[model samples]
Target: MQTVNPQTILKEKFGYDNFRAGQLDVINKVLAHKHALAIMPTGGGKSITYQLPAMMFDGITLVISPLISLMKDQVDGLNTTGIPATFLNSTVDGQEQAQRMSDLRHGVYKMLYVAPERLEVPSFFSFVQSLNIELIAVDEAHVLSQWGHDFRPSYLNILPLLEQIPGHHALLGLTATATERVRENLQQLLQVTDENTVLTGFARDNLALKIIHNQDKRKYVVEYLRKNSDQTGIIYAATRKQVDELTTYLNKIGIKAARYHAGLSEKERQSQQEDFLYDESPVIVATNAFGMGINKPNVRYVIHYSVPGNIEAYYQEIGRAGRDGLPAEAILLYAPQDMHLQEFFVQKSEGSEEHKQNEYDKIREMNAFANTQTCLVRYLLQYFGETVTKDCGHCSNCLDTREWVNVTVDAQKVLANVIRMNQRFGKTMVAKVLKGSNDASIRKYEFLRELPTFGLMKERTLKELTRFIDYLTAEGYLQFEGAEFPVLKVTSSGAEVLKGQKTIQKRLEKIRIVSQSMNSDDLKLSDNDNRLFAKLKEKRLALAREAGLPPFLIFSDKTLLAMAKLKPQTDVAFLSIPGVGEKKFEIYHQDFAKVINEFIVI
Candidate 1:
């Protein structure tokens, strides 16, 4: 048996000098045998909380994870530190499962990761009860709540299984993004007290947020990738059809691209994920399912080809970028029609009435977010219950050099038409009436055709008029009524504007002066540092191939960029770098120093 402390295990195993903001507190609570919940942002070091205590505790620590790929990645990373860690899931065969069970009963491993659905199997539950499980850590704990963005019914089985164990065992829950309501749901479900819950702020200043109003999504994405050349990125579409189409378009244009979705076979999905992880293709065009298990840290940007249905999903998706604390960007290509697609999804999902209403509320909030003219980062932070007193100076809104337009005259015309039509039409009919279309719908309704406001906005295109209606809906000047095929109605606030009692202004994208370019040249490193970084990356790729691991597992791109900039020549100097601790330096210092020395001497 080995006698070790948490500090020693952290230093010797993970190669880091200290814990992240909330890690030490949760680790301390777990080591003291108390129930705790940690609400942290992505890349905030949630794994270390339970891992360190698992090493120090007497019996095995059980980790309940959502994805098998995540379990495998964690186990692989732990093996590099010479720690005994294993995973039990459907991916393993019967013989391997038997052997692993035998090894576990013999106390050969300190930690084991299992999926939540495993608890429902009577034999597996009985077998787990036989072991001396000292602690239980739930990863992605937000799945336990129906109010959460990614709800999994399997998570409800965890608490009952924990109760089935003979004695008291510590519980530690971790999630990357949970709203205040979802956090309360988790605490009540897990029996964790409010005092034991720790929330690290949800702001990632390294990631810039941008919303682009583009009609041609394929062309926009292609031009965006071309502008940010030679960088690793992900383009998330709303559906598999769009993903396949974009993948083909990028590949035809000589850009290496891969597509992933639920439609692919398990093997194909795994291969596509691995290709992106290994940098075979620096670009992956995928749906939301592509990123949950991915641990790649060098993704420079994340572009949403269509707006997501809710803010939580959007935050989690964009949080995948700038994971190493380097500069990154999140660009969302939004069109007024994206909202209709999201509404269809919300209506089609299986849920109770309250759940459906909640989903629709989230959709409206997301629409307002995409149509806002305020600081993008501030809007996200505030939505997540953080009080951001200052603006994040890097977002597109914060950096906007556009002039505001007075749309009071046009707004009055649109609102007046909605009123004159008796508030009985959807946006399409109103847009047609405003644009002076001679369609049958308008011709059949003589009253609508003869209204004074009809054709008031004939100079504008239908798309332009539809955008105005969406903007008003998002701003609460207009409201939609109905569960399906919602029709628009005028609010009292809108009536005032129509009567010339109030003014309306809009931050129209078309009127905004594009005085500056959107190129990422400002983020480029110096030529010398770029050369050194390239050499270091080559060495890392070779090391990763020899070890059969992802290159980021050796050292992240941010760590490599630091090495290239500082050009550390000694073990002590290398250890001073952010990602290099004593254990990692001892293993990789000489190889990296050799490369740096060669370049410096030249």
Candidate 2:
């Protein structure tokens, strides 16, 4: 196998100076006809693995995608790069489909994107036979595994088609999220040996991860959008109704936002997505369905309005930002009720009891992530089978400046109460007993009168007690017994804590920070500095107006804030802020710096 120069290809064809990390290596292996599985982060250039190889190979590359919009987006993006690409899916009429097949047979397209369902059709199979196939690329390949975080039944049928292809063709699987189980499934489905497998590490250094505690998520979301008005970002909700409600709320607050979800008509979804892609809308409030195939680089943040099912889903959603190798943010808002919602989902799923139990266990593991005091990035990476020594200073936990108190004694007492109550009850009953809540249920059960540990921790609210129990379960001090209406079972750790043989420490809960007054200190600028910053912003707006771009395209608020602080004397120093790239620096740096210099002297 010859080594293809990815840099040369990047410059000549894609107009990029270099390949992102793991791109060149993955592409090289694929070009050599080796079956490969790439575990790249969401914005980590996974597409180029097979895309660049497709350009170098002799035949058309067939890429199987799960979403129809994603296929169209990829096809359009390929065409923009002057690559002849087309897609076959239900979106195209019968006549157009026939013509596309004819085009494929006549060697007109170098890359072809198709949905998995379409791949099962006889006509598509015949077309594949007629074309010289270089490789088969499966995007979101983790969907093929039933054990994966997100499973699609349509993807399960793609394995047999690999054997049906006529010529020598390599297989490439790409996804932002895949655990060890999902990786094994990909190998088995693609028939790739262990030696042929390539697992890229899942550490995304450019993104800062955060989990914010907020019971009133809607208020927090609204305030966040209002404060960060001129940024390109995505807000993910768990349901379509949420997407709609949040979109409407943003509009009510004077933010140009749109909603995307599966419930929307195909045309509506397409239009909304295009508007967002074209910068007609700077923000998109959406469900998980919105971001699979859409590639809009330079997204500065991805905010989760609700907790995701697992770390895998979380990583994939957050991967949408910072694709252009720039800094980005991923924030998650969580509450205890969210765990109950996930538990409900687990109970409602149609599967074997054991399978359901496995899913429930995974959900607990995921919920523990919200309560952890360790490095958020390291925790996420560890879930995906990577090891990191130190905490990432960019995450919320690292930036937090709060004092912690030991809760081991309280935890021991709580466990003792649960044990005294026979371990047959749920978390609610145990919490009520601990908080001295003599509710009807507690009174009927006579738990309030138990002298062993009744009202010992009355200072802690019901919410606090419940959180401690959740932490206890998360840290293995308590376990859930598998039965209808699951019971909380004290573990060995619980026993030790009860006997004073071990100690369990927990951070004292911090008060949730409302987004209303965040950065208020900075919001108060000196009158002179405010006037100067306003002038610089006016100059920026004028340049943006002249150039027909958004104000953010000229400079972000962070950049303006930096200008106020640094009061740069030269263009070089002025361009050093958050979003002032070379292109913008060339356009507005000197003018802004001159304004600052003149104001400072005055």
Candidate 3:
């Protein structure tokens, strides 16, 4: 038997010419039989790190993922490449799962993907102990850190499970999005030293970020879809009801659309996901449930019908677009009222006080991102503790103009009202009191009407006043009293603002992008090239259906676009496309070449 080089294995097995930025480093360290913590952005080839090592090792690699959707997608792709991989998850039945376990015991598998909960089963634990587990790879490893966004209590069991495994087995922890704190916590959890970890930059230069303040999001969504109808995308709403409404509206307007959420049956959700992945629908209106580990690389845009709960979630969701290293867009439809929806969720979540406060703080960061006038990418990077001296010129803020508004007077009034009320009231009550609402509660509390700042903001609407209070709260002028009701209380900074020592300059409407150009699709292809690209996509879809694979698995849109533009006539020219490697060229080059030749000759 001969040992193969990792690069040789990569080209022969996975059909990639080169490893992504952080992939080779992580793989090298893991092959050295050391624990590795890798922090790469979405679509950064985090899977290849452990995947390549698994093929080379003498035993099986155990991959623990958080979502079953993720595990199934990975196993499917690996099998498409002729790799011996299987997943053990709740989606599979008892008989099939037992067969898989039996196969694992016989060393018929090189890789196994499972959820963390599976480790808690005593039978599964004993079964894994009987196998030669060479490495443990934890996907979405941020879930193991309580300080990270999207913490799962079940993920804590991973460390204990690893301890139970005998011998010197390597550990690999991987996540697409993690702040500095999250990264530190993951390192600590994995027990990987700094020298053993890889921190790839989180910037996705191909994604164009846009923030739209559309009062009528439905109309905006329809018109935007009308312009970019040829491209596939995802529209993420904040709730199940909104997902259904958006899906219906898009379909009614002659657009092929689907809906996905936890409210649907498992079969329905799976069907919807397959439809979108197979290009049966060009658009999917869904919640956050739709896009964890989905590998469709041609998503040209990701539109947010409502703002997300945190920057971590927002970044991860938008990353689904342009995953093939082509240009894509991310448009956020932001309204001040949408903040309340996330706040409601934060208040309702089950967690400790510290965890709840962490969530609240994340929400505040999200609010700041919504209202920021600086470079949106810079703001995001800074939040994650990365420094960029220059602005990324692609985001809405960098492309638009922003003006500062003097909100010192409004800030003073809001702080004054909170102080007068002894900071005992929530944001809504403070807004109501300041706006002089003549409701029954105001009538019943006669002393409230006697406060000096009671009616100072009567000219402002309750919504406007509440927004101001929220701005003050987010800016550190006020703090939430407790985790339950989120009452506003003046902080030390709030006291300074009230004493006329600190000034308040808010960019309330400063970073507004004109609605006309707001829906611009920034893909740099020409009309003729786009037409040819669309035709190539049809060809790819036909091949995908014939092969029983997703369109991207056959060839990504990026490759098809290249074929359309370059009109590759021979196998050599076809192999030059970015995603085309040795094995892929051997399998797919002739078909793509025929498509290009026919198009050119016609």
Candidate 4:
């Protein structure tokens, strides 16, 4: 028996010319039976590190993933590529689980992906003790660290099992988003050495980031989708109702869309996810729950309909787009009120006071990402403790050439009104008084009408004044008291403005699709090749429908574009396309080549 070269496995099985920057290094360390901590960016070939080794290893490689969707996607793709892989997750039934366990015992598998929660099962833990497990790869490995964004207690159970399994076993911890604190924690927990740690700096050249503040979110979404009508995107709302509303409105306007949230049944969520993945629904409006482990590679954009909980979650969510190494966009529709809801969650969440404070600090950082004048990418990278040299020159802030106007008068107006109200009213009432709207709440407080600050800025609309107040709150000019029903209070910063000691330069410009040029689907498709790309996509959809596999599993749009451009007729020519391998060429080469030939004739 001869040992297979990783490069040969790379080109033959996985369909790539070479290992991505940090991939081979991590693979080599793992193959040497050394634990590795790989901090590659999302879509940076982290999977290949463990996957190629799994094929060459003598025993099964156990992959612990947090989400069932990720498990299913990878398993499906690996199995399609002729690498034997399966997942044991909540989605599997008792009979199937039993059968899979039997197969594992018989050494019929090379790699197995399981949710972290499964390690806690006594039967599952005991059954695992008997198997020859060569490697343990923890995907989204930051979950093992409490300091990380998405922490899971179940991840703690992974390392102890590795100790019990007596053998030369290697552990691999994988994550794209890890702060310095989180990275150290993962290294300590996984017992990974510094030499084996591969830190690929976090930067998505294909992804353009945009942060849109103080805009009409619903209106912006509708218009933005209409502009990018042909593209597929994920719209993440902060709540279930928002998801439903956006989905309904998008569909009502003749745009195909689906909604997903915790409110939906398991079967319903699965159907919605499939609809999006299959391209039946080109857009999905979902809460944070929809995208963690999703393996959809061709998502054109990701729009956060509201501010996410933290930069960690936001950065990870945006990493979902442009995964095929194609240009994609990430738009964050943020407003000041969005922060209040997240702050409320942090305050009410189950944690120690220290934990709550840490969460609060994260919220402030997320707010800074929205409010910062620096590069959006720089802010995010800096937050994750990476040094950035310059601006991305493509984010909303960089593209925005709008002049900042002095809003000192407006700030003073808002502050005086808050002070006049004895700092007792929330943003809404304060705005209503500023706009001179004698609503029922105002009538209830009859003394408010005669107040010196009341109706001082009647020139502004209720909405405009409300937004300005929000900006003030976000900028720390005003503070909110209480959690659920917060009231506005003037911060010392606001007092300074009122006293003419400081000035505020506010850029409340309504953010449209500012990155239209940057976000353009400017793929390198020639006019003649564009026709073939469409035809190839049609063939892909047809084959995917027949085989019951995601279209990307057969071939990514990136590969399809290559097939169209090169118009490969021979097996050699076809396999030369990136993402094409011997196994893939054997399965799909002829069918795609036939399509290309037919298109050429037409």
Runs with alpha carbons beyond 4 Å of true place in candidate 1? 1-5, 412-425, 430-456, 479-482, 487-504, 511-602
Q: Name the candidate, 1 or 4, with the larger lDDT value.
A: 1
Error of 1 at 318 (Å): 0.9
lDDT of each: 0.84, 0.80, 0.84, 0.83
| TM per candidate | 0.78, 0.81, 0.78, 0.71
Q: List candidate 3 segments past 4 Å from native.
A: 1-3, 93-99, 346-348, 442-448, 474-481, 489-602
Model 4 CA deviation exceeding 4 Å by range: 404-602
Alpha-carbon shift of residue 52 in model 3 (angstroms): 1.3
Q: Give the TM-score of candidate 3.
A: 0.78
What shift in Å separates residue 572 of candidate 1 from its native position after superposition?
A: 49
Residue 560, model 3, lDDT: 71
For candidate 3, what is the total of clashing residue pairs? 0
Model 2: pairs clashing at backbone N, Cα or C within 3 Å: none
Q: Candidate 1, residues 441-540: lDDT per residue as tens digits? A: 8898888888887888899899888877888876668887765566789998988888889887666566534322222353357998899999999999
Whole-structure CA lDDT of model 1: 0.84
Decoy 4 TM-score against native: 0.71
Give per-residue CA lDDT, model 4, range 1-602, as digits (tens): 12899999999998989778998889889988898899988778888998899999989899988887657777888999889988888889999999999999998999988887887788888888788999988888888888888776667877787788667888899998999999889889988777888998898988999887656787688778889989999998888988887786566446789999989998899899899999999999999888876768899999999899888889888988989999999999888789888988787788666666667767766775687665788877887888888989998778878788898987888899899999888878999888888889999999899898888999888877876775676567887765345678888888999999999996656545443211224457788989889999999999999999999999998888888777876664675566775568778877988899988888
Query: What lDDT does candidate 2 reach at residue 163?
Result: 78
User: Which model, 3 or 4, shows the larger TM-score?
Assistant: 3
